[model samples]
Target: MPRQHITTHIAILGCVCLGLLAYLFHLDQPVSVYAGTTSTAQDFDSPGSVSVVVNKQRPLGDPGYVPAVLIETGGISLRQEAAEAFAQMARDAEASGVAITAVSGFRTAESQARLHDAYTGRYGTEVAESISALPGQSEHQTGLAVDIGASGGECSLKACFEGTAPGAWAAANAQRYGFIIRYPAGAEHITGYAYEPWHLRYVGPDAAGKIHGAGITLEEYAGLYEPPSAPPSSAPGKNAVEPVP
Candidate 1:
């Protein structure tokens, strides 16, 4: 080979090698610090984010009353999957003689607006803002949340069902049937809602059990199931004791 040609080939090969090294270096770079702050379709673990968007498709059927005891009621109408899981839970609870009822379900955007307005009117916007999620942002909008209580209005969550027979029973058993307490009594900061013992979510048994066993929030579980590229922000209160449920 000609000397000049050999020199040119060597130069080209060096350039290619340098390019490959640069590419590898880029891939090895630390993950971005701002990963979870923005929305991205990649977050499959966060089913709530995907399901909460406003739409005409109400999962739980047209606005109507479902057997409350059978399901925890929430602002969103119950979705079919959620309703089914709740029914199973009700049956389980009934087997033990506790009658659970749903106090609320499926709130349309308009309904959420009214509810928020009502609470804000009474509690003031700032306080209500902390307690009440904005319409689209609410988990209730997904029709996956159920608020449970004793048959009579006499016992709201304040009844301490978490320790009572039914509450304790449900906590111990809900995971087997695909229902998980979405928020626990002391996990308010992680869940961004006050401790709502009555509220449960349907993430299926395996996930529910894992979360329940972990004693963390769905937010944290979702974060762990699909961790962000960067380190996590300080969680709301203390780190959640367990995941969802």
Candidate 2:
């Protein structure tokens, strides 16, 4: 082979090897890649995304939007990915002596409207808005949020549930199963809801791990929270509706 041709081939091979190395690096640090470049706001903001941010300030783009794929688990429906993760989490929780039951999941717009109206009628609009989501603003309508409880229904949906065994276990271990207690204590200002220990939202393992480790609300993790000076004009005071039995 000619000397010049040999040198050119060597240079080309070096470039190819460098490219392969970079690709392998990306694969090894998938979350970094996801968080840095390839992961756009759209990934976590769209209605069907596992990491979608549904909150008072960020309602579903379509008021009547529903998840395309939902599956039943424990007599409630969740997006397929969330349902599968919840099933595994439930099994593991039971194995660990904490019985977690799904109390509510996947509310439709109509159902949310009905619940919100009932709460408004009973508590009056101002107070109801503090505890229940207005129609088109509830995360439950996204099919990614699940209201959970102990198997025997101890302290379900109430603030005291945070002290229950299932709640404690889930608070500690739910991120492993890609769930987060969506409205965590003292984050109501950012999340637009009070502490809801039983409300678990599936954001997939990577975001769940990051959110859990950072101890931040999804609104913060997703950069959706606004400071008081520049608050969102349409932000609802509360963004979750209590499950009505």
Candidate 3:
């Protein structure tokens, strides 16, 4: 082969290698990390991220993960950012004559385990899994979830709450303040839980607004709603339950 031809071939090969490297680098990046994607606000995989998606299929990175800072709001504890947003939302609700109260928030993994155990004992593993979340899989452990209730405690945690003033108001307005109804009615298949009208998950105003506007769960919004490759196992003597929101 001519010397010039050999050099030209080598140059072409180098360019091809560079192009391949560039293509691989792009592939390694998260598609959602780019602007205009469904989730562009924050990291969805980090346990401490406001946009983190914690479902039965997607447990927290650390089973014992806790928020860096928690603040009390309406007698419940939430991460500082979530608490602040809730306070604002509460004030707004009260101003509108719809008093919102936080009945439960910021449960630890241990606390979740206790609740799960109690529910399992009463309802059996199958029913309990639908009503309650397992340890590490519960968003309440992230200090970004708050169970809202009426100030008068009417229909507090039951399905009836969705009809109450507080619940109705929050359903319509919580997204404006950076919260979403974590488990919506008729979405049990996607969220893995029954309708929890009182449960609100803070995902920042941007994400909350987008999710609310789209009428989808965080799992769907973050692209984590697919079935796991392997089914999750339960404790000895307990039947494996489906994933919960």
Top-scoring candidate (TM-score):
2
What is the per-residue lDDT of model 2 for residues 140-217, given as tens digits with 9 covering 90 to 100? 988999999988888988989989999999999999999998999999888888788989999888778888888888
Q: Lowest-lDDT window of 10 residues in candidate 2?
A: 31-40
Model 2 residue 50 CA deviation (Å) reads: 1.1
Residue 4 displacement (Å), model 3: 52
Clashing pairs in 3: none
Q: Choose 2 or 3, whichever is better by TM-score.
A: 2
Pairwise lDDT winner, candidates 1 and 3: 3
User: Better model by lDDT, 2 or 3?
Assistant: 3
TM-scores, all candidates, are 0.59, 0.79, 0.77
TM-score, cand. 2 vs. native: 0.79
Model 1 lDDT at residue 47: 31
* Superposition error at 200 for model 2 (Å): 0.5
CA displacement after TM-score superposition, residue 181 of candidate 3 (Å):
0.5
- Per-residue CA lDDT of model 1 for 63-108, tens digit only, reads 3222233333332357777777777777878987876777665555
Give lDDT per model, in order.
0.60, 0.85, 0.88
Specify the highest-lDDT model's number. Answer: 3
